[model samples]
Target: MKIDEIDIRQGTANTPQRSHGNCLPYVGVPFGMNYFSVQTNGAAGAWFFQPDSPRFEGIRLTHQPSPWIGDYNHLLLTAIQWDDATQKPDLAGNYRPTEATFNAHHLALFDDHFNVQTDLIPTAYGAALNYDFQQLELAHHGVAIQLPDEGRFEFTATGLKLAVSDYHGGEDQNLTMFFELSIPNFDAENSGYYDAQNHWHTATNGTGKPLTLLLATTAATVACQLATSYVSAEQATLNLQRLQTSTSATLKNESADAWNDYLGRISVRDHHPAVVQTFYTCLYRLFLFPQRCYELDANQQPVHYDTMAKTVKTGRLYTNNGFWDTSKTVYSLFSILAPELLPKFLRGFLTSYQETGFLPRWLAPDERGMMPGNLVDSVIAEAAQKGLATELMPALLAAMQDSDSKSAISERYGRQGSADYDKFGYIPADNYSESVNWTQDYSYSDYCIGQVAQTLDQPAVAEKYWQLSKRYLNLLDPATGFLRPKTSDGKFKPNFVPDRWGTDYTEGSAWQNSYSAFHDIDGLIAAMGGKDRFDAQLTALCNAKPTYHVGGYEMVIHEMSELAAVDYGQLAISNQPSFHLPYLFDYSGHPEKTQVTVKQLRKLFNASTTGFPGDEDNGSMAGWFIFACLGFYPVCPADAEYALGIPAFDQVTLHLADHDLTLTTANNHEHNNFVQSLCVDGEPFDAVTISHQQLMTSARLETRLGLVPNH
Candidate 1:
């Protein structure tokens, strides 16, 4: 399947808290610093685009990752019909939803009421926008740009210059991005600024204006090429001059070529077209985050503004990534396809640590630290295990130790209770809010530190963290088989409802979080006494009704409601917490059960506009789908192996770093869904796991499936 044929709207058709993948229709190069989406409705804040909305607000150049984190530097670009104010339509005119195209490389809109054809072609730092008003009867047609709430703009003969107020969680919140927009052949004098009072003033020169786009032009086409820079306004103008020479159509083709080069890395041959489309669509999402934030200077070197130190720094930098979301899947996948990119990202993050004095937990423009866990531990550790970026092992291990040894000045960076956790082995409920989850995640993070240490040949560091990794066992209530919160004196929380969402757990109840001991799955099962009891408990966790109360959260969040809506039992695949739950049965010596559960879970995803069954979380869930479709999953990312699962495709051709690794399934018909047997390189592979070494070598993986369970 072609990259241009993939519609980004399939993943982005959503609103806040609601399922159906709460993603924006992003149009940019993979891992671009900025993403562009056509905003049909502007009322929802960061949830600005909805495919069903009838209104065309503008094209929003957004730096928003999620509605939960909101937006930092954002602005709007819209086309206006310059008729008499009496005869002119509303500022936000009604448009045909059917007449707009939503895809990764192209965003084109046709508004008959305004007689405007607005099309946007995206690059990493800028975009080419074409606004055609050939059919409009008005004497002049113009483009209106609404600045951010605290931004400023100025107009010139060719185009304009503006400053986008930049902030998302850094010490230097007052930083700004300088932009140069090249829109030539338009009426320069009539285009100036709009005040808060809704009055337009013509100006050849101005500063600190809230709006820019009052223009009356005779030209049929208004061509705009916008570029931004953190270096200076002069650099911004130079950047625009370099890339704005092509038409929007030509730029769109160029962006499409870039995407094609990326998406063509892996392809599935001789599969259903819908299935093929879903595979490529997921691959598209896998590259959307950890956006490249630095640009080349006049000397052709990487430079980015250090938001924490309020200084321009020389180094590679990236932002808009949540390690909690990307650690397990995105990091692991990249280790296979692009081995070299991992070191670049890790070095960029190391630079962030040097500037900010801490490794980032979650970064938008800066550290937001929204989710639980210092998951970058897993990210760096996985890289170490895969031998992808061994050169950065020393610094990466140091960053992990730094985050583990000391808490940040604020609770949002590094571990929240690093000192306390090191002392108590578990976060006491009295001392922390989400102590249970904090404890659970810390255990896995400790394992990650050990992995990196072991790779660097630090045996003592490896041994100490390996024991610390099992700290989740301290909080496990053996009586209930759940990792319940324990008080300071080491007693489990008095009241425990397995369905009570978010009291001690992150987004789930006790049942969902109990089995997250990824490093010690065997030890966790042994803690439950054996396989019979463990199997029974894992089964009960799924068979129970998806019930909840306000035991933890004041009101039920959407995950609870989504679970009930899907009737998937307590196995909430709609969220990330439960992503590995279905596969947990494999640990209980029931690979057949894991097979059936994952196959049923596969039914929830399709190639429709609302493609995902739940929030894909920056490709974490899609990464799960990508793995499951290929007949395996890396259940524990800290380890370098993948647990087997039912393959969704008949033949998957993976373009790995070394050689092509093809995974084929015999009798992969819809009815023959269970994996009966597996073979690799014409030999019967009896093991339930495949290592990265086994995958990197040139080989063929073939599995036989049956309608009945393998058991």
Candidate 2:
């Protein structure tokens, strides 16, 4: 299948209440600054879209990677029929989903209610939108530009310039979006401002109204070029001027060409198109996050607005990613296919450190401090291991250590409970939120920080963090075989409910959260009482009842509900915590068990509207799928070796930065699920683990398949 054949809506039909992919049907270039999607509902907060909805709210200009991370600096464009000159513009109309093209290059929505069609093609900084009419009788129509929150707009003969704020706008005066657009050069007589109450206003400064910019003439087609900036409205105008020459067709073709280039790199040949389609769809989603946020100056130097400082600064930056969510997968994928881009991302994090005096934990324009653990340490350390981003390693390492030494001035920038973790090995159960998972995550981050330290050849520094990483053992309860939360005085919590969700756990119960110490599973096994009991415990975790009691939350969040909805047992693949649970059996000498579960999971995902079992989370889950389907997975990001599993496809080839790496299986089929034998370059390969170096340099991997379990 070709890139254009791959539908962008494969996994995008979702609401916050329930998710197919928990993803937007985003139409933009890969890693674009903004993405455009049709809004099915304007009143809903982050869950504004449903692929099956008959309501067409408008076309949304969104910077939301996940509904959980609410969108910032957004606006919507709706075509209004303007039934009469005295009538107010209506922002919502009915449109059929069957009439729209929801894909990467083109997003076309036709409204039967208005007899108007809205078409859009996106660029990195902005997009080109075209409106087509069915009849000249409605030639007196206009466009309503709606802002969800308070904003200011100035309408022009060409288009409009406006400024809007992010979600956390009340306290954050720094977060201002400067946007400008160029269209049919409509004059003042055709444009007007209307408030949220539908009252036309003469002033453009207040927050009361949405701006209505009318067309120059009721032509058969109307077009516009929109540009957005974080720095100033002037740069937005400059961006519009820069891309003014490109037509909508030119942009649509260019966007498709760009996607074709990226998607074509990894080609899979299989008789089953559904399998192939699923592969490409997963590959497509892997590039949607860590969006480019900074803009370029006249001198071609990178510059960005400091949301924390509320001032303009000179440097490259990225936003809309949380390290806690991404550290386990996304950057590691970059290490393989797109190693060249790692240094630039690292530099962005370094600049983030320089500006804030601490590496960001989570940033959606700025620090939101959402998840537990400052897992950016894992990203830097993993990149350091790959020899990517070497130049920025020094500053990155300094920031890594800062998370260990000092707490942030605000809770959002650095590690939480750092002081408590330093004084006590684990946080007191009653003290912090999600203490057990936070303790485990911090311990792993310590090991990652040590990896960076060792790469810098500071053995003493490396040894220091390595020792701290093992402190997770302090909270391990030997009798119950769970890592329970501890008190400040070194005692376990009084009432321990193993199946209880979210008191000390992060979006998980005890079963899903434990066994996360990939750096040293051997040590963790010993702590839990040797490999036999550990293996049995792992087995019980999978076959045990998938039941939960909402202990902490007033209401069960979606993850808890989704986990119980499926019979995958405790494996909450709908979320990230249980991502590596199937692979954990390998550490206990049960590769066949891992093979069975992984193969079962491959069946759960397909290329369709409701494909993913859970939230994709900026391609982290997609990366996991890609790794699993390829027959190997990065079980530990800080570690360079991949734990071997069964490959889903007969032949998998990777066109990397330098060379091509291929994996081929003999006697391959759906039922022939177990690996019978393996060969690398025509020689039998015995080891279960392959180094990152071998994968990057080698050309082919040959493995034989058998119907029976190897165990």
- The clash count of every prediction, one per candidate, is 0, 2
Please state the error at residue 446 of candidate 1 in Å: 1.2
Highest lDDT, which number? Answer: 2
Q: Write the per-residue lDDT of candidate 2 for residues 219-300, one digit (tens) a residue.
A: 5677878999988989998888877888777888899988887787787876667887888888888887788889987787
The superposed Cα distance between candidate 2 and the true structure at residue 529, in angstroms, equals: 2.1
Candidate models: Cα lDDT each: 0.80, 0.81
Worst 10 residues of 2 by lDDT: 208-217
TM-score to native of every candidate shown: 0.97, 0.97
Off by over 4 Å in 2: 169-171, 202-216
Model 1: how large is the Cα RMSD against the reference? 1.8
What is the Cα-based lDDT of residue 24 in candidate 1?
Answer: 81
Model 1 spans > 4 angstroms off? 84-89, 166-169, 205-212, 245-250
TM-score of 1: 0.97
